[model samples]
Target: MGILSRASYVIRSKVNAVLNRSEDPTETLDYSYEQLRDELQDVKQGIADLTTQKKRLQIQKRRLEENVEKHNDQARQAVEQDRDDLARQALEKKKQKMSQIEELEGQISQLQRQQDQLVEQKDELQRQIEQFRTKKETMKARHEAAKASARVNEAMTGAGDEMEDVSRAIERAEERTEDMEARAQAMDELRENGALENQLDDRSSLEKELDAVQQDGEVDAELDTLKSEMGKEEEPTANGGDEAAETELEQELEDDTVSDVEVDDSEVEAELDELKDEE
Candidate 1:
């Protein structure tokens, strides 16, 4: 195809596409039905006009025929009365009336043919219009139903799209929440490890620190009582061990008899005094 031809074809296609997209089948059918009804009305009106004209022509022909009969009677009476010229004039008028009647008859016949054709046409047109109306209504109903179904389908599609988006959004939200929780847990673990290293010398040290911070005077009082009781338990055992050691040493010294040896009175007196001082 030529460039211009291709361009025209493309333009026509676009126009057709626009028209098809914009067209409503139900409205088109209704408009076509209205047009058919209007045509039917025109046909009916034409038939009525033709019938009216035919009737008028028939009336005119009847009057002319009556005049022709009257003229014939006048001619006969004039001929019987021996007035040939009047008879000729009467015959001439009758001929003229006959011609008028003949013309009226022709007009009436033509009008009758036209009226008959118009009636036939009207009937056929009416039948066609009725058939078209039925079909139009059927088509319009179907179109309306289809349009409603399409609207329902569109709504369902929109809902489906929204639901799909919502589902994805929920999934994304859940993922974010999970990531946030994981991050929070990781930070908490790091904080716990760091705090344990710096503050909690041992596992129980954290508990001891917490208890110390939280304790009232009652805990200190209880600790004091426990320390006093431990002191009392150690005091008896320490004093008893020292006393038993002194007694054992005294027995051992008494059991040992001094070696028999000549000694001076002064030395003996000094030794005895020392022993007394030691006791």
Candidate 2:
């Protein structure tokens, strides 16, 4: 083919492809149905016209028959009155009318045949159109059902464009959530290791150190108070009334001192463990 012909062919192919993509089967079927109905209407109109022509021909033939009967009467009267020329003229006119009637009958017969053929064709075309309409509706219903099923499948499988977009969005959200969790865990680790300080705290480093020293001094004072209370509870109240009692009191004081030392050490260890946990 020539370049122009090839170009035309390509254009036509592209147009057809576009049309196919854009065409709705339901709408196309309806359009075809309408076309068939319009054709049926045309055929009915044609039959009606043919019938009207036949009726006109029949009416003319009836008038010609009436004229022939009138001519016969006139010819009979003329013979009775001995007027043969008038009778002969009337007979000639009647013959002409009869000939015209025969022609009209032939035309009417032709019109009747055409009308009958057209009516038959119209009936056949209408039957085909009805069948097509039924098939078209069934096909349309199937097409609609298929479309609905396809949409449901696409949604379930996440295959459609909107579903894909939603899937991506969910993935992005999950990634962001994981990242935030990781960052929070890292921050907690840093805070626990004293690598990161609380931004909300207003105290300077020197002030914090001073506060720590003050807290330690308070703990030491509380420990001293506790030790004095224990010492008072363990002290013997006996006067130096007997040597045995005095010796026993000394022994008890020594044992109490050893127990107090052990308790003090335990209390100190517990305090240290608490401080470590807080840090």
Candidate 3:
């Protein structure tokens, strides 16, 4: 083919493909049904027109028949009155009327035949349209059911855009939830490890250490106060025993001092001589 012819063919094929894709069977069927109805209406109109023409012809034929009868009566009268020329003229006019009536009858017959054919065609077309309507409705119902089933299948298989979007949303939500959970767990771990204390607390590390030392000091001071309080509580119970032991020690010391004084002089002289000899 020439380039122009090939281009035209390609264009036509593309247009046909587009039309096929865009065409709905239900819509096509409805359009065809409407076209049939319009054709039927046209056929009926034609039949009506044909019938009208036939009626006009019939009326004209009736008038011609009446004229023929009037001419025949006039011819008889003319013969009774001895007017042969007038009779001949009247007869000639009657013959022309008869010829016109015959022609009108033929035309009427032809119109009747056309009307009859059109009526039959109209009836057949109507019947076909009715049958097509029934089939179209049945096919449309089946198509709708199939379309709904296909949509459901696409949703179930996550093949549809909306279903795919939902799947993606769920995945995103899961990812976000997992990330949040991981972040929360990490925060908990950091808190447990005391690594987040500086971030969470308003204190510097040095300040925190100072606070800890202060707390320890306060605890030690409180411990010392408790020890002092306990010792004070026990001191009253031990004071009487301490005073009795002190009196017993003082009595023993006085008795030993009196005995030492009684032996000192004699013992001193004798001890000095014994000490010198032993040396």
Candidate 4:
């Protein structure tokens, strides 16, 4: 049983391999339909040839039969006249002609059988081609649908990446805005607690120093004494000789002699007389 089964499996495998090599069912179906059409044409030609041959054979057969009938009639006449040799020759020719007619009839029958078989095969192949065409269309539609689904999934996934990036960007912007808001609130609180006022006093001190920088020391001191108390420093003078010495030193530096002119009572009287005259 196993050997038989293995033989049958081998036969099926060979048939399947041959079928696979011959053509792809989808492609073969199309080519088979074309070949079937050609085969049908060949069948038509074969039928026509067979029909013509059959007609020719029938005509020949009929002519041979008529000859045989005429020969029989002649043979009957010959026999009535007592000539047996001519009648015997006529019967022999008739037998040979009948054999040829039978041969022609057999050939026609064989050709007709082959033509019918070809026509049946053509029809069956055409039906299979149509079935394969429908299946191919379904397969093509499935492929297109799968591709479209993949594209849709890819587009959705790409959009998800963009949405993630946009979400992160929005989160960063919100964080920056919150940080700025917090800083502004801190500044406001500092102002409310007099810390900002203390900074203003520091600025006022800088302005006062700037104003005092361009003034003379006494002026700065007077302004400072207004802010505080004033203190005085003492100095010393030598004597009454200091004034006479300073006058003599001044006349000597100027190269003028004090005794260059006589100081007389008459000159004093003259200066007094002039003063009296002017009065």
Q: Residues 1-279, candidate 1: write the lDDT tens digits.
A: 999999999999999999999998888888888998898899888888888888888888888889889999999999999999999999999999998888888888888888888888888988998899889888888888987897788667765566678878999999999999999998789887865254535557678777777686678777677657556433454587779997997887776655565669999899999867755
How do the residues 1-279 of candidate 2 rate in per-residue lDDT, one tens digit apiece? 999999999999999999999999999999999999999999999998998888888888999999999998999999999999999998999999999998988888888888989999999999999999999999999999999999999999999999999999999999999999999999999999999988899999999999999999999887677657557444565666656786888999999887754357888899999867755
Q: What is the lDDT of residue 224 in candidate 3?
A: 77
Residue pairs in candidate 2 whose N, alpha carbon or C atoms collide under 3 angstroms: none
Which candidate gets the maximum TM-score versus the true structure? 3
Q: Which scores greater on TM-score, model 2 or model 4? A: 2
Question: Candidate 4: misplaced stretches above 4 Å?
Answer: 1-67, 80-82, 147-279
Order the candidates by TM-score, highest first: 3, 2, 1, 4
TM-score of 1: 0.57
Cα-based TM-score, every candidate: 0.57, 0.66, 0.73, 0.36
Give each prediction's root-mean-square deviation over alpha carbons: 23.0, 11.2, 22.4, 26.6
Best by lDDT: 2
Candidate 3, residues 1-279: lDDT per residue as tens digits?
999999999999999999999999989888988998899899989988898888888888988999999999999999999999989999999999999988888888888888889989999998998998899899999999999999999988999999999999999999999999999999999989987775557877899899999999999887677657556533453677878986998999888877754567878899899856755
For candidate 4, the C-alpha RMSD (Å) to the true structure equals 26.6
Tens-digit lDDT track of model 4 for 45-145? 76667667767766776787787677667777768877788777767777777777687678767766766776677677667667766776776677668
Cα RMSD for predicted model 3: 22.4
Can you tell me which runs of candidate 3 are displaced by over 4 Å?
1-14, 197-201, 232-279
